[model samples]
Target: MPVHRSGSGTTRRSRLAALGTLLAALSLLLTLPGAATAADSPTAAAKKPARGSATMGMGVIAHDGRGGLPGGTLVAQTEGVDVSSHQGNVNWATLWNSGVRWAYTKATEGTYYTNPYFAQQYNGSYNVGMIRGAYHFATPDTTSGATQANYFVDHGGGWSKDGKTLPGVLDIEWNPYGAQCYGKTQAGMVSWIRDFVNTYKARTGRDAVIYTATSWWTTCTGNNAGFGTTNPLWVARYDTTVGTLPAGWGYYTMWQYTSSGPYVGDHNHFNGALDRVQALANG
Candidate 1:
């Protein structure tokens, strides 16, 4: 059985700290213009969309039996081994068949770092799979976030043929480790976010969506007038119906309501209201 770990108490803060360090490193490396050269450019081969020319319309949220909630159309990167290795272990095929149209595989984290499992799965199936696919980086801090994002673009190699990703997401939550970031204040966090987002957008020319829990959103960038409205928000609220989301967050394109779902190999997951996502993207 997979061991389940809860993000409660001191452990949560500790995890955040470790993740912060990882992200900081990633940001630095990706910010470099020639970090990965040809692979890093957006001109690389693009992957085909799963539903032909028809847009599937829904979104997704992924869980690794942990607290990290990455929103997208297809959710990959469960715990244990990479998705391909445990093909028999997790019923991803079933999930795909059951309306899960895309998969965002975990690509990299902090600078000079990549998820070992993600590397395997991405290299093996990202381009060849029928399900439209993209990769996400577990963003740490500014410098690391840039490096990790760059690494993902460089190594993942390719774009969506239709110019739409399976969905590229930036997993932004409170650092579990609670280590004081160089820029931990609200302004600092917002600046860091801007730096990361701007860098990724410049390189990929794609809108890099922001993924955050209610608390993180409210705490980090709520006060910044420019932060909240500039990018598409993928809000994570595990409980309550989507209808009951906080008043100010109606603009959110996707909601990660249930971490536990049938599609994600029986692990906790999230879903997108096809209509809402389309409306937001179109707007």
Candidate 2:
């Protein structure tokens, strides 16, 4: 069942004492590269994609009193999904009925491919009362991040203040071409990401949401800890646990826990309350 705006417990006591210890440990883990713990490390099991119907949903609260989240643990969260051209002609009304409160859609890919259905998908999401966002499939090897960001913005990746739009996303995961890091060195990859996000922020007045896997980030960017403070981290892990986050982020804002869910595209969770998600959309 989808936890709605009022579902989060209002009377939950503060966990400041426990949070302090966890933050200290996390701070240490993020500083050093390849320092993730064994359990948090992406396991073979983590690679399996999620399987379920639109009726099934998972949230940021993957572990409820059973384990930890990116920032120790959160008291509450909500479930959502992301779509692309791959999921053609989404029934937004049906998705909303299936417990999705928000969604992100692919708007552009590699400065060349704009999602042919972006107009409908992006508008359809909002028409159904779902918070909608736009993301770009990055191709850092073909062109610079700034150039790609501009292309994304020029297409359909821009944001609005209607309180229904989430920040633009930079999807920098597996390389469809050959080189996973887009033929760039680790430092070059980091610089590329900086250029993209910096340009995104300058254009939209908000930092871009970073969608990436832990291993990819580690291998490509040396698990750089720079973006966590500035941008929201959208971590991708397919298993039951989130495992380790990228170096810079203390907690993840979104988790793509499964590529296969009740939805057509990826299943996700917004790791905060409805109002918090609204705030994210508001910005």
Candidate 3:
């Protein structure tokens, strides 16, 4: 499950499913009247802070060209632009004041396409964002995973940086324009995913972070031990309310719980604050 354009050309279905699950559960609890107390609320349950936790880092995918909230910093990565040039004008001071902790500049695309200027721009921009970062491709075609990894390493510089990055993310989702990726049988999809993850780890010497939907996880990689145990999961479940994702999978490191936020330029763009992400990362 690699990140792909949704039919609506916005947030991924995995994000929608996560949000749907939370809303459904919250609706059920509300209907029950005495389902849970404030201390036991689902929102509270999903947001309980981790012990000895660090401040949460907010993230924003600055793909579409648009300015968001001036404060509450965003992590914007360009596919082919020199991201460094925009560093000085990125309003980092405002974001820091508003509570932003990290930013992941895009480094590469499909195996053959590299963000030509990421290297020149993101080499050491950590001081601008609380945490600096880099990311790679997550294609549905496992055969291409190795190629994508190699490209990311060769082009994105192997996620090497002076600052601490939230694990390198493999954005697994739907690719509506291409073939039917989600149509693959759960086992087949899991196998493909495992191939990608294993290949990436072998090449990068770093654990790959999986970004996908809960349904994708259950239907595709739920039974695969490789996914269930080896890597961290960055789940996309966009709902009005937040809560723990359904069980059966391993630990999650981030949750993209919404698509409509001031920081998100598009109405359907993906957006999730840092508290949940930090919880997932540190959980």
Candidate 4:
């Protein structure tokens, strides 16, 4: 009886010690920073963008939590559009007929993916008498900004003194395939962008336009205003108004106001009139 009682006591003590350890672990876990919330979780999965697949405004239109009014209609500026591989060979004549005076076509992404339809879209838009530029869908995670910029320059992203070609654009926004901001800290993102911009200016003799959403700019770059003086801002907002711009930008050079055009791609507006579009192209 004595031995049995001793065994029972030992078993109870062992359970109590285990329980104490579990409680201590639970306490530590509760106190730890960055416990996963739904907000921190990867976005409810959509069709993740494949390599060479991401286009202009893909992330902003897909995962930008802010809801833009559906079937949105607002008109009052110089009309424009952006295209990529997704649009295939765009009907530039049709877009021209619809009054789109300026356009941007996706040129390269990271250092690997160049838009297969680039030649058609880039040349087609310019041939149709539209002021067109090429944009790089930046993948800072895949390569350094300078490497991607070099790839972009070698591809269709190069600028010329021609009156029809606008400077290239850097489309930096949410990551469709992974974490927001491509997992970079604000300082790191700013550095990556700096490398691309400096390299692009060296190669092309023009500062690249920066395309982004205000929400993305705040979250990724901590609303860094450093680029405002150098890069033209192509602010994307699919609402009735352009809404608030990111810090440092006194005005948006272009506004991607909606993706609900009657034709193929998203519609945009130059901040000024048709002559102003020519001015940008001239520079």
Best by lDDT: 4
Candidate 4 residue-pair clash tally? 0
lDDT of 2 by residue, 1-283 (tens): 3454335443232466567889999898787987777677786546433221111112222322223223444466777888876678999988899888998988887766778778889999999999999988887887899999999999988888889999999988766445567789999999998999999888999889998878788988999998888899898877667888989898999987776678576787789878888999997
lDDT of 4 at 74: 42
Candidate 1 residue 145 Cα shift, in angstroms, is: 4.3
The lDDT of each candidate is 0.47, 0.78, 0.48, 0.88
Off by over 4 Å in 1: 1-90, 119-145, 180-183, 243-250, 263-283
The TM-score values for the models, in the order shown, are 0.55, 0.74, 0.54, 0.80
lDDT of 1: 0.47
What TM-score would candidate 1 get against the native?
A: 0.55
Instruction: Give the Cα error of residue 236 in candidate 3, in Å.
Output: 0.9
- Tell me how many residue pairs clash in candidate 3: 15
Better of 1 and 4 by TM-score: 4
**lDDT, candidate 2, residue 243?**
81
lDDT of 3 at 242: 26
Top-down TM-score ranking: 4, 2, 1, 3
| Candidate 1 C-alpha lDDT tens digits along 23-88 | 999888888876775565553224321211111111222221223334554433222111322232
What local lDDT does model 1 show for residue 110? 47
By TM-score, is 2 or 3 better? Answer: 2
